[model samples]
Target: MNSRTPRPPHGSSRAGPPPRPGRRTFGAVCAAVGALVLAAPGCGVLSPGSNGQTSDDITVTSTMIREGEAIPARFTCKGEGVSPPLRWSGLPDETESLAIIVDDPESVGGAAVHWVLYGLDPENPELPEGTVPQNGKQGQNSKEQAAYDPPCPSGDTAHEFRFTVYALKADIALPDGAPLDQALGAVASNTLARGRLIATGGR
Candidate 1:
């Protein structure tokens, strides 16, 4: 029962573009003067689509986690037993539903399922920390239980957990507690876009 606090979406922290040479400098100076007259606050210059609000702007991140790294037992099959927090931004305005799935890529056969959640509100970009929806549809994990079953690799080597987020156009039609394949089928049928984050944990 691994538990983890949800992390907030990280806003980009970057400096503005470098000042141009004389010709561009003169144009910039004029723009700055106009901003002063309008009493507009300074604005950050960013590359297009840097903010995760548009269809092409979303970004996903985990708390102190990276792709392919070993995940801590606290968030694995052997600890405090809470779902890890996940955060994302930049969904297309038309997104209606969201789904999340976490799995172990190094499981016994091909890959193993750990957690599956679907029908989340796209408007709510952050899932509450340590949440494992007891009543939500629990899919059949690798162990065949309708609950989160973290990776417990047999050997001493660490295992990687891949967390994925899907932006869908509609709620999946599957029933609660559906099997993993059924749930995934619904996602593939309706997904408009998706993103991923990875972390590792082992005994």
Candidate 2:
């Protein structure tokens, strides 16, 4: 009598052989590597609106507005919409350039970047009202405008605006009308010291 071939053990797949232990481990490693690769883009040295406060602080002030005080109407949308006069001191001796960033923290979508002025001469410790320093470059604000966009908070609640000055160790060479992120990144990376003057604004 002819004998029939015995069936394979249960749980054994006939379609293909079971995966080897080495292959399974390799697959797991590949999956882990893939996960790491996918997560790399979001891993940045600095988050938006953060300037890496790892160094000394400078003293920033304004002639027309005091810290924590309501900003003058001339500097807001309700009036002439001109930039406010600002001053700062305590710059490190190694500072080679200066930058200014004005923003409103209470904005709807993150901090509204009102103005980004970089490549200012370190020799000038103050900026006149409504003036861009000589040879300074302007960056796009939250409205995508290349010039200063005065703070205009919606609703009746007053919004606090930050006028930050960065003292950088190296001069930035960004072109005029650079993107806000690019200008901020350049300022933050080279910042040797910084200061802030907080003021409020409303409709």
How much does candidate 1 score in TM-score?
A: 0.64
lDDT of 1: 0.54
> Which stretch of 10 consecutive residues in model 1 shows the poorest summed lDDT?
36-45
| Model 2 local distance difference test score | 0.65
Q: Give the Cα error of residue 55 in candidate 2, in Å.
A: 3.1
Top candidate when judged by lDDT against the true structure: 2
Candidate 2 residue spans exceeding 4 A from truth: 1-53
By TM-score, the best candidate is 2
- On the 0 to 100 scale, the lDDT of residue 6 in model 1 is 45
RMSD of each: 20.0, 25.9
Candidate 2's TM-score reads 0.72
TM-score of every model versus the real structure:
0.64, 0.72
Which ten-residue region of model 2 has the weakest summed lDDT? 8-17
